[model samples]
Each structure stands twice: as structure tokens, then as C-alpha cells.
Target: MRCIIMSNELTKKAAEMLLNGATLLSEPCPYCKGVRVMKDGNALCVNCGKNLK
Candidate 1:
């Protein structure tokens, strides 16, 4: 298994999303296979550190 590390920015983003009531999704990101979250219809990739569809 491979270990993944998130940068400070990504970590902060995830925390912010959670704090703002974003829902963490079970599906993985298609680009990098990272964990995803959704908020107000926006999908964000916590591992890849970007917004998804």
C-alpha cells in the first residue's frame, strides 16, 4: 500500500469544507483516485487538492 500526504493548503481546504458542512463522498477522484467531498453541488478532491465536477 502507498501512503499519501496532503499539503497544508489541502488540509486546510478539507477542514474548511467539513466545517462548512460539506459531505465527504465514498467515491474516489477519477483523475488521481483521491478522496472527494461535496458542498453546494461542488465536488472537491482532498488528496489531489482541486475542485472536481
Candidate 2:
């Protein structure tokens, strides 16, 4: 349902971020326990799709 759509969006965002040179972090996201990425000193949660600090 809504979660599926959200997941798709998150996947797309993660792919785009990675393609743009974002680094996939080894640590997990604190909020959703999902994979995290970093680029230009910013962190992003691939599952939550949130731009974290």
C-alpha cells in the first residue's frame, strides 16, 4: 500500500544519491535501522529517505 510506494521512492532516491557519488555507510540509520549514505558531510537514510545530520 502506502509503504510500498514509499519504499519505491526511497529506493530511487538511494540509487540516485549513489550514482551521484554518495558513499554508502557501514553504519545503520538510527531512526529506522536502515542503511545510511553520506555525501558532502550530509547523511541520508535510504529506508526513511530523510536527510540526516
Candidate 3:
């Protein structure tokens, strides 16, 4: 077996979000179905206040 480590900030954050069962979406939030959604962080929504992290 082999292993690869993630060191980049974006990559690390993505991996963390994935492990936490959060979907990495660059589109609008499905909950509100609006375009006013803002990125709270690497894994959270500001509009609906959904913690993707």
C-alpha cells in the first residue's frame, strides 16, 4: 500500500470537510435556493447558517 499526504491549505480543508460528511459546493445553497449564499468558511454556509464543517 502507498500513502499521500495533503499539505496545501485548500486541500487540507477539503479533506477535513469530506471526512466530516460535508459536501463541497461552489454553487448556491439548495436549502434556501437563493444566490445570496455566502461562504462562512471552508465548510459552512452564512445564509442558511448550515455548518458544513
Q: Give RMSD to native, each candidate.
A: 3.9, 1.1, 11.0
lDDT of 3 by residue, 2-53 (tens): 1223124334554565676655466765676422222345434434444443
| Clash number by candidate, in order | 0, 0, 0
- State every prediction's TM-score relative to the real structure: 0.77, 0.85, 0.33
User: Which candidate, 1 or 2, would have the higher TM-score against the true structure?
Assistant: 2
Candidate 1 segments whose C-alpha is farther than 4 A from its true place = 1-6
The residue-level lDDT of candidate 2 at 3 comes to 84
Question: Which model scores highest in lDDT?
Answer: 2
Expressed as tens digits, the lDDT of each residue in 1-53 for candidate 2 is 98889988888888888999999999899888899888888888878877887
The C-alpha local distance difference test score for the whole of candidate 2 amounts to: 0.86
Which candidate ranks first by TM-score, i.e. highest?
Answer: 2
Instruction: Give the C-alpha miss distance for residue 39 in model 2, angstroms.
Output: 1.4
Model 3 residue 38 CA deviation (Å) reads: 10
Model 3 deviation from the true structure expressed as Cα RMSD, one decimal place:
11.0
